[model samples]
Every structure is written in structure tokens, then in C-alpha cells.
Target: MQLSVLDQSVAVTGRTEDASIRETLTLARHCEALGYRRFWVSEHHSHPTIVGSAPEVLMAAIAATTSRIRVGSAGVMLPHYAALKVAEQFRVLEAIAPGRIDLGVGRAPGSDMRTARLLSSDPRQSADNFPIQVRELQAWLAGVDLPEGHPGRGVTANPMGPSAPEMWMLGSSDYGAQLAAHYGLPYAFAYFITDGQGAGQALDLYRANYRPSPRHPAPQAVLCVWALAADTEAEAWHHFSGRERWKIDRNRGALAALPSPEEVALRPYTPAEQMEADKLRANAFVGSGPQVAAKLRALANTLEVEELVVITWAHDPAARRRSYELLAREFF
Candidate 1:
């Protein structure tokens, strides 16, 4: 299986948000050295926990700092901006790192409804236009003429070159699967977002309905999963306490920075909260390097996906880096 990374630039308690962004850059270079296939960043607008709001901007920084690793957005929220604008930005990124950019796009707001409205140029813009936007973006990125009668038929994305970003459809639902299959583009299921719910159904739908396109003659699917690995199984669970507590609190509408394991240990969990935490831990991939690798292999086999995009969150940035490092050693 091909291993990749999807970093959310997670904010941690007692650290400035800027530090989180810098850590993502550092992690990208680190992952490259570890022989990972790709390093993708995420987009989340005005989010307290996930601070990676501008994936295009972050992609540029990562491209400049890393040589071999493929850099791209886990996605740019398609509904939030103009298709041509996104295409142009990615085209420029391709110019910087030809044949190494992957343009993953999605329809989700990536923020609260109100914040989404602020990001949209047209206040009345509907996500229903996402398919149309993706079609236009695909044409622009490929330097092909838009179909007749289209409003952006004549306009072009600037800095057109021999290479273009590889476009991938990203989502946590069936709608994205159907759309991706229709376009014959690569699809990445957000297994982390829904905690594996609906993943099998979505991937099944994608491959079944996939149409052949020039760039991708066959269906290409990726699973983005949340996992953590440590030197030992017990140590791994100890660090997992922070993420477990955060998940429980997040379900109750709390969007705080990731707390340290020490902080989480100091506070006692209610029985109800403990139950929720246990559920999360049970479903999570947390253990020593070999153990996590075994679980990852089993998941890939069950899902029939060749590529696994791992995303890890920890209070200490070093731990996050170590998680990826250990996984890379096990796989690569």
C-alpha cells in the first residue's frame, strides 16, 4: 500500500496558532525524508481547532521546502470560491513543482454556515453548483476549452504549462462518490471525519459507477484515516487520552485546542463521558508501530484501497512527527 499524509495544522493548547502552521511545514519535509508518497494539507475556515484555512497558500510553502514529496490540498472547498480562481492558484503551484501537485476539491463548507457565507463572493451561491464548478475547474486545469454556452468558455487559468495538478474529489459521503465517478476523477474518502461510517458504501458506489476519463482510465480511490503510533502500546494509549477527551468535548460543541495528555490525565471523566471516550478509543488505530501497521493493513485489505492517507493529532508536535515516522518505517 502507498502511504501518504493529510495534515490539518491542528492547534494545541499553550501554543500560538502560527506555530501549528509552521509545524505542518516542518512535518511535510519530515515526511518527505521518511519516503511518504504525498503530503496534503487541509482547509478549514475560522476553525479554532483546525487552523489550515488556505490550502493553496500552504501548498506553495510546502512545495518550496520539500523536493520529492507530492504536495497538495486535502481539499479546497469548491463552494467557497470561483472555479477559475482556484484553477489559476493551483496552476501556479504546478509551475513551482511540476508533476507534484494534487488538487483535491470538495463541496463541504469547511466552516460554520455564517463563515461560509462570508467566504463566498456571491451571497446566494448554492453548493448545488459544486458539480458545475468542478467541471469548469477540470477544464481550466487541463487547459481545455469549456463547453459552448458556458460563461467561462473563453477565459483561461494563467501560467498554463505542460503539467497540471492531478484533480481528486474528496468527501465523507455518497454524494461526492457519485460526483467523482461521474467525472472519472480520483476519489478520497474522509474516513477520519465520519469515523468509518458510510465509507464502504461510498467507495463501493465510486468504483461501480466510475467512468473512464483521459487522465484516469480506471477508478482511483484513497482512504484518509486518523491513526497514531508510539514506541509501545501503553505509551500510545497514554497520548491518545488527549484526542479521546477532545472528541468527547467536541461532540458537545467544544472546539478547544488539543490539550496535553498530562492535562487530560489531571481531569476525571464522568461515566457518560468515559463511555463516549471508550467508544472512540475502541475504533481508533493507536498502538506500537507494528500493531498500528497491522490494523492499517487490515483496513486497507477490507476496503480494497491501495493508498492510505494518515492524519494524526497530538499535543506535542514531536509526537505527531514520531507517529508518521514510525508508520513510515513499518510500511516503507
Candidate 2:
């Protein structure tokens, strides 16, 4: 099916529980043992909900622990940082993990407008420059000579850096699709971010306008989705019940610890919250091995996605770990 499973690092925790960095490292190492194709750490600045704000730092830890699995950002919100610096850091990571590193960049600053403005002071950078940054980073990794007027010409990256980690354009919108087409790198669509809109139009735009380059002749696509599997459908849904409630509360300016499955079930919820929860879970695939496999397969055909990255959030860390293990056993 040309399908590969993927997971996001959320630092799984209970309502009042804390997930230690040590525990996260262990979880990631366990995934490597479980044989996932790639483990992607998302980038978010100063979020109490997630522990992976610095993807490179976490990559260093993960790279040290595993040998076969590819590790990189599901996206490292590129607009927030310098391309050369990102290139250098990933080059170092590539030095350690070699062919196993992947770089997926997103245009979003990953926060509210106020916070985005604080992080990305320049108002001029929109989706237009994302392609340029990806190209610039690729050149930096390839050791291609920079343009004479380019400010980064003076800086040098690692001599031992592996062939630049495979680059990917990530987005939930058409702008990212166009950028991916222009650059000819693999493109990933976050179905989780799209809120149930059909990505077909955007994917069509990407394939139609795709320009072939030596680096990538065929366009590659990944559908990023929220998924979970346990011994039973009820257990899987219950396992994810806390994160589900957490998401329901996140919009109300509440970032409190996630409630446990039992607590969320017992707790009262507004009608509005219930509606949103239904929509979120509508995209979420939670069930047993056979059921999850069937849902994922159908999603793959419906999206025509070359790869499937299962980005999950579960209430319990152990349950989250088991989810990966289950996927590995069924699909890997």
C-alpha cells in the first residue's frame, strides 16, 4: 500500500500527571524498537501542553537512543527562525543519524496572532518565502554556493553532514501545496488540521502544478491524521478520552491538565463543547487492530496519500506507547 505509520511526540500525561523528558525519551526509544518509519517531534514555543518546543534538542536525544528509525520535525514552523541556522542544526543531526533524518517545514508560526507577531516580527514573510527558505536550507545542506549577495555566504555547515535530510513541505492549506509543487519535495497534508475539509482540491493543485527537478521527479504525499488502536474500540476511545476533553477545553482559554477518561466521562460538558468534540473525533480513528487497519486503508485510498502519519494524543503514556506498538505490529 506504500503506507508508513508516523507518530507525534506530545509528552503524554494524565490530567494531573507530568510526563518527564526521561519518560518521553524512553517512549521514543520504545517506538524505534517497535519499528516505526519516522518519529516526528512538532515545534511549539512555550506551550505547557507539549514538551517538545526545541525539536533539535529532542532529536539529539532520540538520535542517540535509536539506530534505524528516521527522526525529524513533523514541522519546525520555519518562519520563526533562520534558514541557515536550521540547516546547520539538522546537518548536525544528520551527521549522527545520517540517511534517517527528515526535515518538514511549515509556514505557520504555530500560535495566536499576538504570539506569532512576537515570534515573527517581520510582517512581510507570508507563504511566498517558505519555498525560498526550503530551497535555501537545501542549498546550505548540499554545500551549494550561495548567491553573491546572499547574507549566508560566509557561514559554513558541517563537512561530514550526510546528504541533506529529505525535505518536506507541510501544511493544512493550498499555499503549502503550491510551495511543495514549486520545490518538488515531498508534501504532507495535516488532515487533523483541516477540520474535515476535503484536501483533494489542494492535492490536485499540488500534482497539477508540480515541477520536476533533479531532486524529486515524482510528487510524494503524506496524510497526517489522529489515530489510536487498543484491544477494543471502546478501550481505544477511552484511552484517548482525556486528550479529547483537553481539546474541547483548549478553545475556552483553558490549558489545565488533561482530565482522565473517567473524570471526563463523569464531568459535565456544554452542548457547544460536545459538538466540537464530535467533529474532532469524527476524524479520529480509534479501534482494534483489524478495525484501525481498515479505516487507515480506506483513508489512504480516499486521500490517495503515499504515506500515512498517525499523529495521536492519548490520555495515558502507557496507552500511547501501546498504540504505537499496535500500529507497528499491524502495519509495519
Candidate 3:
């Protein structure tokens, strides 16, 4: 199975955004050397823990820093910007690294409603126009004309060449699966965020209804999940404690930098919080290299996906890197 990474450039309790970005670049290079297929960064706006607000800029930086690994967004929230602009930005990236660039688009806001309004021209629109946006983006990227009488019919996203960046639709629901199937694009399921709920159904729907397009002739699906590995099961649990605490805090509407294991150990938690954490933990894979490897392989086999994109968070940058290193050694 192929393995990839989806890094949020998470800011730890004691680290600055600059430090977080540096760690992202370092991790990209490390994963590339370790033979990862792709290294994708996330986009979040006004989030205390996440530092990746602009995936296009970060993708360019990662592409310049790494030689072999494909770099892209995990993805860019499409509703926030014009499709033509998004296409242009990624086209420039394609020029920078050609086939190494990917344009993963999603419909979510990637932030709270308040921040969403700030980014979007009309935040109150109840009906989602993401299907229309995707069509425009695809047209611009392919340098093809939109349907006659369309507002974007005459517009062209410049820098178009013989090849465009690969596009993948990212979603956690059946709606996204159906949309991707209709468009004949590759689909990536956010299993970590959805806690593995409805994933089987979503993938099944995508495969059953998928139409062949020039970009993706066959159904290609990727599963993204939270994972961590350590030398021992106990140490891996220690790394996961912070993630558990972070999830609890996030559910309570309290966002903060990723706490350290020591900090998590010292915090007092209610029974409900503990239950929530346990539930989240059940969806995550944390153990020794072989243990995590076995679980990941089983999951991939069950999902029938050839690629797995892992998202790991820890207070220590070294620990995060080590986790990927161990997993790569075990699987790759």
C-alpha cells in the first residue's frame, strides 16, 4: 500500500507559527526521504492550533524544498475564493513543479461561521454552489470553455500548459462522494475527522457511480486517518494523550495549542470528557510500529483503498517525525 501525509502545521503549546511552518517543511523533507508518495498541507483560518492558513503558498514552499514527494493542499476550501483564482494559483504551482502538484478541493469553510463570512462574499447562501465552482475550476485548469452563456465562458486561467495539476475531491460524506463520482475525479475520504462513520458507504457509492474522465479513468480513492507510532505501546499512548485532550477541548469550543503529555496528565477531566476522549481514541491508531502497521493494513484492505494519508499530531516535533519514520520502516 502507498502512504502519504496530511500535515496541519499544528502549533504546539510552546511553539510559534514560524516554528510550526519550519517543522512542516522539515517534516516534508523527512517524509520525502522516507519514500512517502505525497505530502499535503491543510488550510485553516483563525485557528489557534493550526498554522496552515494558506495551502497554496505552503505547497509552493514544500515543492521547492522536496525533490520527489508530491505536494498539495489537503485541501483548499473552494467556497472561500473564486474558482478562476484558485486555478491560477495552482497553475503557477504546476509551473514550479509540474506533475508534483495536486489541487485537492473541498466545500467546507475550514473555519467558524464568523471567519467564513469574512472570507466569502455571501455567507448566507443556503444552497451550496460547490458543484458549479468545481466545474469552473476544472474548466480553467484544463483551459477549456465553459457551457455557452456561462459567465466564465470567455475567461481563461492563465499558465495553462500540456499538463495541469491533478485534482482530487475531499469529503467526509456521501454527498461529496456522489459529486466526485459525477465529475469523474479522484475522491479522498476524511476518515479521521468523521471517526470512520459512513466511510464504507461513501466509498461504495463513489465506486458504484463513478464515471470515467480523462483525468481519472478508473476509480481512485484515498483514506486519510489519524495515526501515531512509537517504540513501545506505552510511549505511543503517551503521545496520543495530548490528542485526546485536544479533541475534548475542541468539542467544548476551547481551542488552544496542542498540550504536552505532561499537561494532559495534569488536567482534570469529567466523566463525559473522558468518554468522548475514549471514543476518539477508538478511531485513532496508536501503538508500536508493527501494531500500527497491522491495523493500517487491515483498514486499507477493508476500505479497498491503495493509499493512506496519515495525520499525526504531537507536542514534540521530533516525536511526530519519529512516528512517521517508524511507520515508513514498518510499511514502506
lDDT scores in order: 0.94, 0.76, 0.91
TM-score of 2: 0.90
lDDT of 2 by residue, 178-207 (tens): 989987878888887775475887788899
Local lDDT at 229 for model 3: 97
Per-candidate RMSD, Å? 0.7, 2.6, 1.4
Tell me, by TM-score, which candidate is best.
Answer: 1
lDDT digits (tens) for residues 1-332 of candidate 3: 99999999998887677899989999999999999999999999999999799999989999987788999898999988888899999999998888899899998889987888898776554228889899889889988899999998888898977789999999999998999999999999999988899999999999999999987899999999999999999999999999889989888889999999999989888999878877776767999999999999999999999999999999988899999999999877
**Model 1 Cα lDDT, one tens digit per residue, 1-332:** 99999999999999999999999999999999999999999999989899999999999999998899999898999999989999999999999999999999999999999999999879877799999999999999999999899888899999999999999999999999999999999999999999999999999999999999999999999999999999999989988888898888999999889999999988899999988988888899999999999999999999999999999999988888899989999999
- Badly placed stretches (over 4 Å) of model 1 are none
Which candidate wins on lDDT?
A: 1
CA lDDT for candidate 3: 0.91
